[model samples]
Target chain A: MSYSPPRDRLWFLRRRAYLVFVLRELTSLFVAWSAVYLILLLDAFADGALPAFWDWAGTPWVLALNVVALAAVTFHAVTFLNLAPKATVIRLDGWRVPDFMIVGGNFSAWLAVSALILWVLW
Target chain B: MSPLRRRAEPYLWLLFGGGGVVSALTLPALVLILGVLVPAGVLSRPDLTALLSNAVVRLALVGLVMLALFHAAHRIRFTAEELLGVARWDRFIALTCYGLALTGTVVTASILF
Candidate 1:
């Protein structure tokens, strides 16, 4: 019979990477929450959906929830950006591109898109 | 990888990957706008209806929702099973998670169109 190693419930907690992985995984929930907030913002933008809608959204609880979600989103973004190189590959004429360029390109795209959003909104 | 495992995981991973890019870029910006700027009364809500009602914006918004939802589903599904030591109910959990994501996507689409 083959030998089988016993594992505990906290086996994953033994490693630093595992902890980060779990936190990153949990970030997905907040990512979805952020999407939900976006949907609400979109739906609330009716013909007269201005002061009243904005006013309705200015509650303390909503603010707190959003703050928490924002933190989660920020954390998730940082982790995801760092991990992007691992998941993707870039090649030019049968040559593998440098890692920093690939990562920097992602950051540049992120900044450009975010800047566009800011310009559009403001 | 086993064929059965590969079939489900690759597609899920693709969604997860694409979703990761979109979510990483947009979600942070959104949190900044909605959570801090608007809430702090720094940036007021502009003509959001006009902006969102546009065909391109609506399409993009819908796509973002779908991607983000699937990302959450895949992550949450795996995390739950692993953390909870759930082995036998893997398929059921997956279906539930993906099903929820699909339903959310449908609802968002209907509302948009």
Candidate 2:
């Protein structure tokens, strides 16, 4: 027999950072939801039921679901980008990039791409 | 236990990290076009059907979905154990999460290709 410590299931709530971590984990569901939505888009495209795609996506509930999923995915992306430098080490010419530089560059690139997409669509 | 189980963890983790990178790089832009701009009628929907009709785009979409799905599955599997304290059910958790991801990947590929 070995000793096992009893722990609260709500341990995540006891600390703010842990809560953020848990929320980040929960974002996985929405990430999967986005993938599912993308699958539907591809399926509709493959079958040439193109109008069906627009028609279904236009539904209020679908819009709402997409809105929620979008929010979650956005949070996931932001958190991951902010956390990335901690998990990564980039060196150029035998010099490591500073953490702020890495995070700032990641954010700058994200903004540039987002602007590009919006620009093209507009 | 499968002989590959222990060895597969690191690779799966790599996939998760790669997927996170991919999601960060692509999904926000997608969400902006899809979630906010289009729905708000600020940006008109382009020839998305024509755009995605390209084989390369379809393949890329499949890759994105596949990796994202696996990343979700791995993260959720651990989250389930942590939140629910279901460590004793690790095998069940892994099977369910990974199985769903596999199904999603197959369906994504079949539909895309």
**Top candidate when judged by DockQ against the true structure:** 1
Evaluate residue A73 in candidate 2 and report its C-alpha lDDT on the 0 to 100 scale.
85
lDDT of every predicted structure (CA atoms): 0.83, 0.82
Which whole-number lDDT from 0 to 100 does residue B9 have in model 1?
93
Residue pairs in candidate 1 whose N, alpha carbon or C atoms collide under 3 angstroms: none
| Docking level for model 1 | medium
Instruction: Give the TM-scores of the predictions, in the order they appear.
Output: 0.90, 0.88
TM-score for candidate 1, please give it.
0.90
* Candidate 2 Cα outliers beyond 4 Å, as residue runs: A1-5, A92-94, A119-122, B1-3
lDDT for each residue of candidate 2 in B1-113, tens digit (9 for 90 to 100):
56788888888899899888777777767865765556556666567766666888678878999889988998999999999999899988998988998898899888766
lDDT of 2 by residue, A1-122 (tens): 99998888789999999999999999999888887877887687678775667667767888888888888888998999999999888999999999999999988887887787666545
